[model samples]
Target: MAKIAINGLGRIGRSILRLLTTTEAGEGFEIVALNDIARPELCAYLLKHDSVFGLFPKAVSHDDSGLTIDGTRYPLTDNPDLSQIDLSGVDLVLECTGKSNSREFATRGLRAGASRVLISGPCPTADQTVVLGANDEMLGDQQVISCASCTTNALAPLARAIDTAFGLVSAHMTTIHCYTGSQPTVDAPRGDLVRSRAAALSMVPTTTSAGRLTDLVLPDLAGRIFATSVRVPTASVSAIDMSFQAQSAVSEKQINKMLAALPAPIFGTTTEPLVSSDLRGRPESIVMALPETHVTKSATMARVFGWYDNEWGFSNRMIDLARRMTSM
Candidate 1:
């Protein structure tokens, strides 16, 4: 069987393993090795009990030998120098540590001996950036690739689908996002005062690269799409509040129909009054809150809500892009 390696056993790295080992979507790839700055036991502990996903429904243990989940042991390494870690048979390395978002670090991942590298976050200097179902056809013979940010994964598909169904004239999006591992629990230095506040206590407004990166994925909406983000006191799912001005007028019914008609896996529509936590384990890239769909009185502008389990869905997308890269 083909093999893979996880360079950082962070939220994304662990989620990738879960997608490959725990679920029905558990794919053909086997994670043969792991690299992280933390100890294997700590990594195992976090993997076994995710605050966001709940307890992993599988036997989990770790030792100097390796980290085992569901009775399958994967060799674990904690070398601070990633290139020093062996990835001999690793077809691809998932660069999820979030520490290395630069070309220099991405190249270091490739140096670990994998045929290719798939970054879980944006790496503009990466050979190519892709969001599956949107612009994956643009994937070429690139050694290092990025899946972009979670916000891009959640927004790009809707952009592509809406742009295809009805011409997108201009769009302004605000991602009502959840706090990630990056934010500190209490007020501390985070390179900015706004983001330095307590993560669980307040909503912190911040910038997002989703629009610029989305433009890279689908050039048609290059300068027309704009986005911002606000980190709320949540741990699992995130949402995008988008107002898209179409080329022509359209009703809320038409907008809802367009969303409902989207491909189920990439874009989903739900009529239920679901909150953020309700979407905690959803695998779809973006789920339209059907009842919340709104259109301007003039019908030229439509407002919609999209929810996504940032970590879970993005991890799934990593698997999808990884499978595609390995196939090539």
Candidate 2:
């Protein structure tokens, strides 16, 4: 069994803990410790009652000593500076603290004796950025590996499929993402002008690094893709709108067939006109919305839609990547 530690108890972090304790994916891995900024009580409360995912089994609880779930207790180190934490016996540290997507932060885990550090989002300084089906083959013995952002996870596979069938000329993606911890429920002052507005009552547009990160993982698609983001009022799940020009003729039937044939854990396709709420807890990277997929008369250009439970899917991928790294 591999020993693991998680930093941060936010949406992604809690989701990771939730899966590790309640699902089969949690097997064969032991959570040695956890580091976060919240008080032990607050973290436990959030874990037990997640507004988006609903209450976890009553078994989830915590105290000043640490968090307890699924018959295991993990020591909690409530600090933002990871360098001060004691990570003895930890084989991997799943760094979900969005703030630690850097080389310096990754090194902290390694220096503290972790065999590897798996970050939740992409980091240019990390040794490798594994996007599962897209470039998991490139995973190496790097001390630091990134499980690229939720958007990148959802986009890379589609980009690969489109590029394989019809050469990608250029692409633009707009992610209709849900409000996150970074955004406030009511209008509040923030350094970033757009994010300062109320997240629950507005459709706020913001920038996304997913396109740039996607290019890093799939070098062939570099400079050919761009992305924008819009933060919606919803609390969970997200929709991605993609428009692209391909070198070959396109047809709905062909595109549908292509997405339909994608392997498990990567994508799933459906013709139903489903709402974002319908995918609240799915673990697939993306679920192609066949009914919304459109193609130009000439088939050289097309539009595609995909929906995902960003928090749950991304957290699941983090565990999968961590396990793969330990196996390697």
Candidate 3:
């Protein structure tokens, strides 16, 4: 079995762990190590409190050194330093830390003998930004990969579907994302240069790396996409409101049919109203299209809505991508 390492046991990391535990033995890869800068107790608390998958596998056990799951015991590394871990047997590493998106971390994992690194969040220099249903074929085994943001994964396939059916001229999106670990429950001093003055009390207008990374994943739509984000008070899940200018006339029915025709394993479509809460544990759906609301007032303009379990959905993709990379 191939060995895997996860960095940053936060929202996405914990969710990924849950996915690995629930998947069938062969489909689920082995977790060799989990690292976080915070105390080990935090990771323990998360594993114990997981609502969707419940507790981790009984075969799994952890101590101060590390935890063992499915006959694989991953020792806990003292620090988040990538170079410190014994990567001699690690086949892949998943970096979920929302820290600066740098290739250096992934590079370190590779140098430590890891076959490949899959970054959960946006990286400053990602060789490829993959949206599972949209452009997973773009992933190559020779380089490190970034899964982009959860919102991007939700929006990319929708955008690509429209662009493929009827050429996309320009697109804009406003992602109503849930509050993350990076945000404080109460107002506190911000750290990064751009987010320093922002507050959690109100929706803050912030740029999203999604649109920029989306272009990389689907280069055909490059320069035609832009996005902004507003952090809401929710704990998990997020919504995306997207508008596109099509090159030709297209009705809601036409777009709905296209989305409905998508394979079940990758895309999900529903006639009933879809809410963020409804998508909580839906692992296979990278994007859910709201058929009722999709519309086009003119030959060039169309609108769509999508909901995503940002952590679970994106983490599942990261795991799948990691497995594919290992197979090569």
Clashing pairs in 1: none
The clash count of every prediction, one per candidate, is 0, 1, 2
lDDT of each: 0.87, 0.88, 0.74
Q: Candidate 1 has what TM-score? A: 0.97
TM-score of 3: 0.89
lDDT of 2 at 201: 94
Writing each residue's lDDT as its tens digit, candidate 2 over 85-200 gives 77867889998888765678777888777788999987778888889879988998988888989999999888988999889999999999998888888889988899999999
**Higher-ranked by lDDT: 1 or 3:** 1
TM-scores, one per candidate: 0.97, 0.97, 0.89
RMSD of each: 1.2, 1.3, 2.8
How many steric overlaps does candidate 2 have? 1
Model 3 residue pairs with clashes: 65-76, 101-124
Q: How accurate is candidate 1 locally (lDDT)?
A: 0.87
Compute the lDDT for candidate 2. 0.88
